[model samples]
Target: AVLTKGVTPINFKPEFADADAAEGEDTDPHAFQSVANAKIYVKNIADAFCTADAEGCDTYKANAAVYTEKLDALEGDVRTAIQSVPQEKRVVITSHDAFGYFEKAYGLTFLAPEGVSTESEPSAADVAKLVSQVKQDKAAAVFVENIVNARLIEQIASETGVKVGGTLYSDALSQPDGPASSYIDLMHNNIAQIKGAILGS
Candidate 1:
């Protein structure tokens, strides 16, 4: 019953100990957003489920540990890849505002035509304003998100005379066989794309 945006669904029914309690179901549903969040979710789920389903507690804990290790390794790879980019050219523009966690984690500066949420299209004025900002900022590249329409970014690139950088995966994971199915792969692909564009520019 727990739900999270951009996370694969947990494919099981959760049973609470206090079934008849008046309060709503308690869960930290968006648990896969970060390693820390995943850790918390595993702890909470284990405590709750261990009481109800003792036989499966150890298995769940083991799986969580394996996944956590992978996440940690992915974080390291992201750090190294982003660090490979020159510090002076670290800023870039994208079509949507979906990179706050990435910016915080990977030391990237992301400018977007839209605001923090991609719930609506950017107004014409908004696009023009961002174009001006990109030129003023001397952004290294103009990138489009895989999930967003690229026309605005193309327009911005044309206006600024900067090349279309590359497609970045945002919000949703790519297909399992693609370059960005996992968070680590997404970060690596993005950094490589950005670095290539900026260095080539």
Candidate 2:
């Protein structure tokens, strides 16, 4: 693998590469900052390919432009969908913090028991704190990620008396036959699940 071979790891987007970045303060280095960063990441990859083959790079760039346009449209659609929901009603509960970037890019508030990874169990203290927060905030919904166990979220929902919302895609794409097979499908599915759960509850 290029990574194991010691190939330079470039930041897909600089904003997502810095450590000092904060949530609402500016773009966080570890999280997706905005939908526009999608274009920058694609363009950076295209530029990387050019280092080896200039001819192939041109084709990559052209294709990237087309895809970037599609991303633009997707961003607009997301904004429109989110605009329909009231601000205070945008709270959601999940088990991990992987959606920080999504919350930053979009306008939703995501509360989680674990930070960034699903490989470990969340501490009892963290779970207790989140449970308290959920009860106090009246979080609109609790959702399980495709890559995470549903037990934690289900527990939260039961304890808080909030319903379990639909599953969201994170960490990877869903199977082709599933609801979030493509990037666009993932975005649409997440927003729909969010809005449906919040509004319906």
Candidate 3:
């Protein structure tokens, strides 16, 4: 009998979060996972720049517009890439709840052991619970995250028999030479890896 102690996190939510989820009680702070929200980040930054340096307002707006266009293209690309996988196979497993916004944006389902904040490690009970969920849901792939240790995910994958599809960039970007060096590249790499894993590529 596994002790469920230390299993339930403050940020834990039901696995099947609603489309407009108040998931994690509407407190998952990784809003940048969604490109649409990311555009808002750019706009806010541009607005701050314009306020700080009125003379550079035009330049700030122009730069924000350019980045926003790039984000638009990236959103479209993400949609197209994810379209290849059938909806039923869209379930994915990752290390934590960081991908909730991503799931909310891309029509994917993400299951994780930890909540949005990864300050603590998931216990054995959490892994066991997640393992059971993986089997029950027939989750397509499991991924390690760039910001957290992969040991927990590895244990979950081993027990559930789900392949460790690839590393997903969440909470941070990779080094300059890494595949996920930028926001656009990060989305592309994540979707490509997800698609490849689910489609058996």
Clashes of each: 0, 1, 0
* Every candidate's lDDT: 0.64, 0.68, 0.76
Model 3 lDDT per residue over 88-108, tens place: 999887766677777878899
lDDT of 1 by residue, 84-181 (tens): 77887788887654555566556778765533223345577766776788878879888988876777777778878776878787667789998889
**Per-residue lDDT of model 2, residues 1-201, tens digit only:** 121122222222232322223333342243322466555676777777777788788798898889889989989988887888899888887754556667767888876543322344556675676688787876888899786677667766777777688988766778999998987788888888888888884
In candidate 2, stretches whose alpha carbon ends up further than 4 angstroms from where it belongs are 1-34, 114-131
> Between 1 and 3, whose lDDT is larger?
3
lDDT of 1 at 200: 74
Each candidate structure's TM-score, on Cα atoms with residue i matched to residue i, is 0.67, 0.73, 0.78
Q: Residue 17 of candidate 3: its Cα lDDT?
A: 36
Clashing pairs in 1: none
Go through the candidates in order and give the C-alpha RMSD of each one to the true structure. 9.9, 7.1, 9.2
What's the CA RMSD of model 2 in angstroms? 7.1
The candidate scoring highest on lDDT is 3
State the weakest 10-residue window (summed lDDT) of model 3: 1-10
What TM-score quantifies how close candidate 1 is to the native fold? Answer: 0.67
* TM-score ranking from best candidate downward: 3, 2, 1
Model 1, C-alpha of 162: deviation from truth (Å): 3.0
